[model samples]
Target: MALPRTAPSSWMQSLDLPSQLFETGSTDYELYEEDDEFVLSVELPGFDPEEITASWDDGVLDIAAEHDDQQRGERRTYHRRFRFPKSVADEEITAEYTNGILEVRLPVEEAVVSGREIEIES
Candidate 1:
């Protein structure tokens, strides 16, 4: 499934809600799979390579970034969430930032039936 982008900044104004004075930026992402590993490509410009944060919960992956441009008097915060099909190996995950693009490799685990039979009425 393709990731969805947030509505335009004017959406709230069109709804007659109070304007959110500050500006909010959007991050774009692409998903793909290769050799049992899911590859996520995220575009985050003007952000330091070390400042982005990412976490996985259940099957959802959350990514957030903050960039402060003092020269232009602008600050931007971006966030995006993605839900993969199965659980990922957190320890084996790897991410790299290059040329404003963040590439992450999430190794997919094999499906295993998780449960145990318990004897009752002893």
Candidate 2:
């Protein structure tokens, strides 16, 4: 999902209104699993690395940023959360911000599937 510079009201979102009404500066992001790890990359321009914060808690990944432009008397904030289907090695999670992009790597724990495949009868 893309992150907007500012989000619409929760009530508006719950109503399922047209997204055009909520249009704003968009921050592109991608999430995928590769080589037993989940990788997430987000585009966040005009923000310094010191202003961004990433946190992982209880299977959820939270990314947030705040920029206060004292000269322009403007403030920008961003926040998003993601959850993984499989267990993640939170302790080993790592993130890096460079060139207006933030990337997070989450190591997925080994999973054991123990269900037999069902036979379909025509």
Best-fitting candidate, scored by TM-score: 2
Q: Put down candidate 2 lDDT per residue, 67-113, tens digits, no spaces.
A: 99999999999899998889998889999999999999999987878
Output the lDDT of residue 57, model 2.
88
lDDT of every predicted structure (CA atoms): 0.83, 0.89
Residue 98 lDDT in candidate 2: 90
Tens digits of per-residue lDDT for model 1 on 1-122? 75436565645555665555534663378899999899999999879987799888888888999988889999999888988877788788898899999998999887797899888985
* lDDT score of residue 73 within candidate 2: 100
**RMSD, every candidate, angstroms:** 8.4, 8.6
Name the top lDDT candidate. Answer: 2
lDDT of predicted model 2: 0.89
